[model samples]
Target: MLYIFDLGNVIVDIDFNRVMGVWSDLSRVPLANLQNSFVMGEAFHRHERGQITDEEFAAAVCDEMGMALSFDQFAAGWQAVFVALRPEVIAVMKQLREKGHRVVVLSNTNRLHTNFWPGEYPEIAEAADKIYLSQEMGTRKPEPEIYLKLLQEEGTPADRAIFFDDNADNIKGAQQVGITSILVTGKETIPAYFANNPC
Candidate 1:
């Protein structure tokens, strides 16, 4: 059996809104008000793909705000709100891998977020036979094409693969492509899904 997991809310605690709040306080940039012009999806996508460096992204925001802040300062402020991984989630992932399952991570994340993953949470990455990250793949979830691409690359039949995610829409997207799925609300509940099923 192959187990695919989402990274962000599934593995770690993240509040991008909190990061923006902290950034606004420190840099005097009102990210909320500049939603359309600065903090929209395209700007974030460029930042994620490294098309724009953190420094460049910050400068763009600063330009809109008529303020200036260094790259180091921006990075520090942006990273301040993130929290650690839940122990239960980590333990369950390791257990899944130990059972000889082909476990992998399939996450919709920016480059910055993916960069922060390794070393800090090696267990999560190591449990995976491989990882499929959105930024690297240039495709995000809740999109059928990405799921099809993953199935092709992993060479795993859709029905034999099980995907776990915190979002219902992503779960739906997986189902649309014939990949079985579970909404990971808690760790204790996950093991039940693995039972009574044969790959």
Candidate 2:
């Protein structure tokens, strides 16, 4: 059996509010406005898909935020989002691997975020057998193409694997691909699932 996990809130805790606070301080844009205005649309998706450079995405976001800031300033706020690693989740991944199950990470994330965390928490790289990142894959979650691509690459049939993700859309997307997926609500969800299901 294969155990697939999502990186962002599932394995590593993150706070978007921290990002908004950092940007608000630097850009003088109200946190509310930034939170409401920052749409995760094509530009962001493209960046995660490795179709745009960091500066390119930063410029687009800066323009949208009405901020007179350089890419460096924008990236500072972006890098501040990671809060900590989720040890409970990592322990489960390790346990599953010890049980002879393949464990991997599939994340819908941009290069900047991906690049930042591995350095801060080296355990993230060690927790999974392989990490499927959207920036390298050229596609992201809630999309059939990305999930299909992953299934094909892993050579594992959908029914043989279980996926854990924090996003409801991604969970439905995995279900569409015929993969069993669990929606992770909080720190306890993963542990709770394993406790109840024993897998």
- By TM-score, the best candidate is 2
| Cand. 2 TM to true fold | 0.97
Tens-place lDDT per residue, model 1, 50-167, is 4666666777766765546676666665675466776666666777778887788887765555556676777776666788877677677888988999888888899878888988
Candidate 2, residues 1-199, lDDT tens digits: the string is 9889998899999898898899999988888999988888889999999999999999998888788787888889999989989999999999998998999999988878876888898897787899999999989998988888988888999999999999999999999989999999999999999999995
Query: For model 1, where is the 10-residue window of minimal lDDT?
Result: 33-42
lDDT scores in order: 0.72, 0.90
Number of backbone collisions per candidate, in order?
0, 0
The residue ranges of model 1 lying beyond 4 angstroms of the native Cα positions read 29-40, 46-68, 186-199
Q: Report the Cα lDDT for residue 47, model 1.
A: 65
| Residue 51, model 1, lDDT | 64
